[model samples]
Target chain A: HNGSVFHPGTIVFPAALATAQAIGASGRDLLVAAVAGYEVGIRVGEFLGRSHYKIFHTTGTAGTLAAAAAVGHLLKLNPSQMLHAFGSAGTQSAGLWEFLRDAADSKQLHTAHAASTGLMSAYLAKSGFTGAEHILEGKQGLAAGMSSDSDPSKLIDRLGTRWTIAETSFKYHASCRHTHPAADALLQVMLKQDLKPSDIAKVETLVHQGAIDVLGPVTDPTTVHQSKFSMGTVLAIVAHYQFAGLQEFDQHFHDQDICSFRDRVTMVLDPEVDSAYPQSWIGKVKVYLNNGEVLEGRVDEPKGDPGNTLSRTEITDKAMRLAAFSGGASPSEMSAAIER
Target chain B: HNGSVFHPGTIVFPAALATAQAIGASGRDLLVAAVAGYEVGIRVGEFLGRSHYKIFHTTGTAGTLAAAAAVGHLLKLNPSQMLHAFGSAGTQSAGLWEFLRDAADSKQLHTAHAASTGLMSAYLAKSGFTGAEHILEGKQGLAAGMSSDSDPSKLIDRLGTRWTIAETSFKYHASCRHTHPAADALLQVMLKQDLKPSDIAKVETLVHQGAIDVLGPVTDPTTVHQSKFSMGTVLAIVAHYQFAGLQEFDQHFHDQDICSFRDRVTMVLDPEVDSAYPQSWIGKVKVYLNNGEVLEGRVDEPKGDPGNTLSRTEITDKAMRLAAFSGGASPSEMSAAIER
Candidate 1:
């Protein structure tokens, strides 16, 4: 595990699963490819920098390489073929932050496209198609177009030594990762006080400044998916529903409780928390109670962080519940697949 | 057709053909989509600018949008659905100039991915998936990530009044468009002087400055496809074989005679040619004979230029030859498919 904060799961998870199914690859190959996805993808994410993040999503950019690397590994591509695969991947690399301003379901499509494209790139290379060898550092390369500032060393340093998948932390809340720390901090407040949503007059959350571009201004999401990015909606869901999970997201737009509570919940940038970012994405929650009592809580990191991991039981419970929810079948019909 | 210089065939041709096959759209719809591809793609390409071309192939970038527009039109998509299609297409838009450096078969791949992605985007929109509405103009939109300078008005101005596809011209030379003018100019030189490759000591060519970027400095290509971008190889193939056609490209890399004359040719910038660039892509060729005789020729526009259209018979001959070269089945097997 290394010290990168990018999320490789969106890129690697869908990519590996799809490619594994397509090729009938072994579990070992799948794991190896998934790991390669994280290592290769997250480092590329770092090179793209915060400036690139202002417009492009790393999952679409770096994710293409991750998917290609994983699929290429499974295909047993030689280095030259892999370079060609990367060349095609780089040429097709794209994902924009513009979707954040729209209520479109493009978020899911991003992962789908990245995964399929990764497989496609690998297949293209296997068919004897050559590609740009120095795709990363070429004059008209990903780095040149996407980012003015990037560290090539970060992309290649400890290529075989560090396993970045080890550093990847899972999400406990189903909302956007940026909204998690605030929701997590508020979860503690709700638990410790045992206060109902009505008992809270107003709620304020403190999050790092870097989240402004991502989770800003889209507070009144018309669609369920959009609610995930709305810090207000995420906090309101946590306050009223007690858990921010798949059901909560599905109900975000229609639920009157979440809607009403959303207005009372607000976020402000905290200098202290902003300084700690992105090394440590911290959140501070302040609650004004109707009973004239104020409650404050802080969390350096959200649940399931590398430093604060979910228990094996918790993860297993989530996986089982998610499998049941997303995968429609009787328990008898699904148990074997779920267990595997 | 409009005055925009972007190539629409790579984007619209595949996209319309595939979508037409998929949906059984009317011939009218297919033609409408192709026209939409040229108009929409060229405008988007304008916004992307030449700087973007340094990194991305416009066929893959603006081309994706063109494909989507064409597919979306055939699908009878409402304005909202079309917006979503564009949104999804923008997210996946990519193609790198890096491939040109590697001489990879990525050129074909760019067109393939653009076509497939366009079909995929439209299909997703039809299925009710959301995409960015302001994918081109949004804060973190395609223009932001791909280009530093853009003219958004060009993307929408006189959309119906000016048809960009009308300006589209065919290529007589089988090489890249940059090499076409030179190849055309050389054809005249060979015909006028009845010269052989052995009779030539050194030859010089004058082409637009922009052509320098496309056909520059790739003198020793190991593949036939790469030879398309090498101005020397294109010229030599014309000089020796007396014609630059698909069959010639298929044989360029392996020919010893073409390789021998490749070294004898060079390119230099001509201010007169540079000034007439987008308005007219002209080439001037000067052949110095070993016998101390000099032959010169100039072509203001290559064969198949809008002002110099290839004869319908010539087009049909090329098409028939190409069909026979690539199609492996019997005439009856093709008849059933060709009838459709």
Candidate 2:
């Protein structure tokens, strides 16, 4: 959720490096271009959309432009030349919608391509090549071609005023957003009822339609990637385990008990719940007891939403946990760096 | 333009650095993530149609997801966490249509944002946060939301077979692609006609519809960025000068003759030529003489296009020229590097 404030250094570094090496741009120019690129990239991207999930992936789409701008700015190109850089990047724009399929590795590649391609575009423009000027607004322009709905004004919207980097969200969980509420809810139910896996007969989950479509109807996930998308699998692990974390997902994805429990769990989809969407990732879980009793609990908002936002302390704690897993830094050091 | 296989290090280095630092990721993991990210990002992006310019900016849109996936992979998060990382990135996705709007700086920003946000998303997910799993395939998924025409299967079309990095283009010019054909055409006309600027009165350019829509309606551009997008500006400089390279773009963007000639040139949009489109970035230029004589030329393909692609020698020559402008390595050394 990038709100505002573009940091060109973010995209510039990558773009400039490639361009510099490509056309033998000086190292000094590369460094300067990198910083400038990030600033321009972030600023422009911020103007487009921060939380518009459906429109485009700002980092990939806009990042290329920023990279090109940084290179153009560094090379001291005229405004028209800069426009060619934009056109070059636009013609080469790309990113995919496959991450949602199974969270494949392509997600990470998007950034690399943008950075590399953008720098290439700038270098080409700098060398007296030409590109489209109306690449974004023409009949087959970026807006008309890439996005269904675009406010052309957004391109120049607050050109230098708002930055997008400021609004970006920092994650504390490694699971799907749709599943966080369920995880939190299950944890709470287990804590309140003090129940063990042995006492539970069947677990029923009611969640937003979006979540159901994404994480429901879990049968059997053979791979680690697929297991994370299975609501049934996630619930199975939570019901039988003390804590649900990265280790649980990685280690028990194919465990027999987890698999068995996943099959026993039933997920119900409700559109009414999905209406709240990103604002409140809501979920409800019912645990049927062997004694003919049903204990129901609902988590209307997950722990990371703005309403249920994680405190600074919570964020740091989570960062520390991840750092520990990566085996690189201590929680305190990670926390300090983030705070700074 | 990047159609051959080259070292991943060249492209991966820059993208990885921006991605890691922007998201507060550790430097140690950046390199590993970058390599892996490049492999995944390129492959996935290529699958989505590397040759098509209509769907989305593959490098920008798909690149973000690739960056996110790389970061997630480096962090070793399960599928659920990776999905969240991608979802976070999806929500923040965007790039401008302004490239077509007089070659705005938005083009460069596209790639920069993708790299930055992808890194950010992964870092967040690593911190034990959540995001949607069906970020791409859901009803409001990336494909459905951003693109009117998308092939979801393209996401994993050839998962591990082909890599996108191998198909990347390394540019040899600093101008717009549309103007490249015109530039070549003008240069050819100059060589053949041996005509001086004093002999030319009016320069009329005929180009494809895409070219006219993008680079036509040329105007006086103040910034170098803007000048690159102006076909008139590019043609004026190339037609008037004996040498055209990076230095001309950098040092002479505001030269009086270039500016004055830019004011005199007119670009006409030809509908009959529009049908050729992406296939042939064709261009025809007519120079009307003060003595009632006419010198006309047409280029069916530009130097960078597949049919008229630049040879290794040409690429090196361009690189050398850029090096001379940057006052760094000689063209020979730069050329060697590119060849290497």
List lDDT for all candidates, in order. 0.79, 0.63
Residues B207-245 of candidate 2: C-alpha lDDT, one tens digit per residue? 665455545534657677678878877877787665455
Q: For candidate 1, lDDT tens digit of each residue in A1-340?
A: 1134456777777777877898899998899888877788888877766677767777777778888988888888999898888888877788887898877777777777777787788888998877888778777788888888667887887778876677778788887888888888888898987988889888888877657778774867987778888888888888877788987788564588778888888878899987776657787999889998889988886888888989877886677767677876655655676576
| Model 1, global lDDT | 0.79
lDDT for residue B19 in candidate 1, whole number 0-100: 80
Off by over 4 Å in 2: A1-174, A183-204, A209-228, A242-253, A266-269, A285-297, A303-340, B1-174, B184-204, B209-218, B223-226, B247-252, B286-297, B302-340
Listed in order, the DockQ scores are 0.72, 0.12
- Lowest lDDT sum, 10 consecutive residues, model 1 chain B, at B1-10
> For model 1, what is the alpha-carbon lDDT of residue A317?
68
lDDT (tens digit, per residue) of candidate 1 on B62-83? 8788889999998888999998
Worst 10 residues of 2 chain A by lDDT: A1-10
What TM-score does each of the candidates earn? 0.88, 0.55
Total residue pair clashes for candidate 2: 139
DockQ of 2: 0.12
